[model samples]
Target: MIEKALQVFPKSYVYRNEELILEPRNNVYFRLVDVETEIDFKCKMFAWVSRPIAKSLNKYWAPRVLKSFNTLMDTNFTKSDMYLIYDRLGNDVNRKLTIRFIESGYDMELLKR
Candidate 1:
């Protein structure tokens, strides 16, 4: 139940035509992604690290966060809902949600790449 985030809007809105993904791990494969390949963080994807620090949620409490999100936002999102459709975490998404990594992706960069 590790957590990874996808941008809901265009990356660097100033560059509207450029799309970017924020990946911070070595092997990040969504359960329903169906593909078995290493993700490319080059192109337009920004390696999920900054001057401060950041990282994806570990395989421990991601589900709970999602649950809390569902409860707090009145949405019905499940683990299976991840990466299974465009509405969840992909391009042309149909929602207006923004990711707030809180402590997860905040200072973990000190311990990870």
Candidate 2:
């Protein structure tokens, strides 16, 4: 599973801290929080697509695509501050979507916190 996940999420890394670790990405560290509930898990994902891709999608496909997918799962999406965010409960499909979004001449910005 780790190998498969790496294929989709090469930017993600695993590190250990003194119980709590700060993720280095600027948008990520402030944007995501892990929560565990009795029956649900919550996580967040972000995609930094190209400027043109982001602008084009902002005009049409983006909102519809997000809303359509949101209807199928416990997911909420937002595009703001030059990033697209998917906050969901259970499942990691957001990572797959992030990869697909990045495939179209888009790249993730690895920012220092």
Candidate 3:
């Protein structure tokens, strides 16, 4: 799964970084990529990664690190709930829904341009 997600981008750019810059792109699909095909492979990779991570509940879990999300309500939640919340936000595995959901607790409608 990890290997698949990494494959979405160029292999030369893979590495551990001490710092990162995260941009909040509300509409991650059409807005970020000029063509929808770019995300088709990514969506599959996301789905693959989400499955196993969704099952793990140990402290410092993979989902927490990968998603880096904080809920609006400060309540204990499971990884399954996280996946469900994201699924409710967007029907697919694009990270846009998760980003928007993390930004606004309410379900945000994705605009099609």
Task: State the C-alpha lDDT per candidate.
Answer: 0.27, 0.31, 0.36
Clashing pairs in 3: none
Put down candidate 1 lDDT per residue, 48-86, tens digits, no spaces: 221001123555544544444344333454544332322
Q: Write the per-residue lDDT of candidate 2 for residues 1-113, one digit (tens) a residue.
A: 22222233324343442111112231121122342331111123233222222353545545543443333223443444234332211134455544444343333232212
Name the candidate that leads on TM-score. Answer: 3
TM-score of each: 0.27, 0.25, 0.29
TM-score of 2: 0.25
Global lDDT for candidate 2?
0.31
Model 3 alpha-carbon drift over 4 Å, by segment: 1-36, 63-65, 68-81, 85-113
- State in Å the error of residue 21, model 3: 24
**Residue 45 Cα positional deviation in candidate 2, in Å, after optimal superposition:** 9.6
Error of 2 at 109 (Å): 17
lDDT, candidate 2, at 100: 44
Q: 2 or 3: which has the higher TM-score?
A: 3
Which residue pairs show backbone clashes in model 2? none
lDDT of 3 by residue, 1-113 (tens): 22333333222122233111121121111122221453443343233333433443344444443453222133344565546643543345456654454445334333211
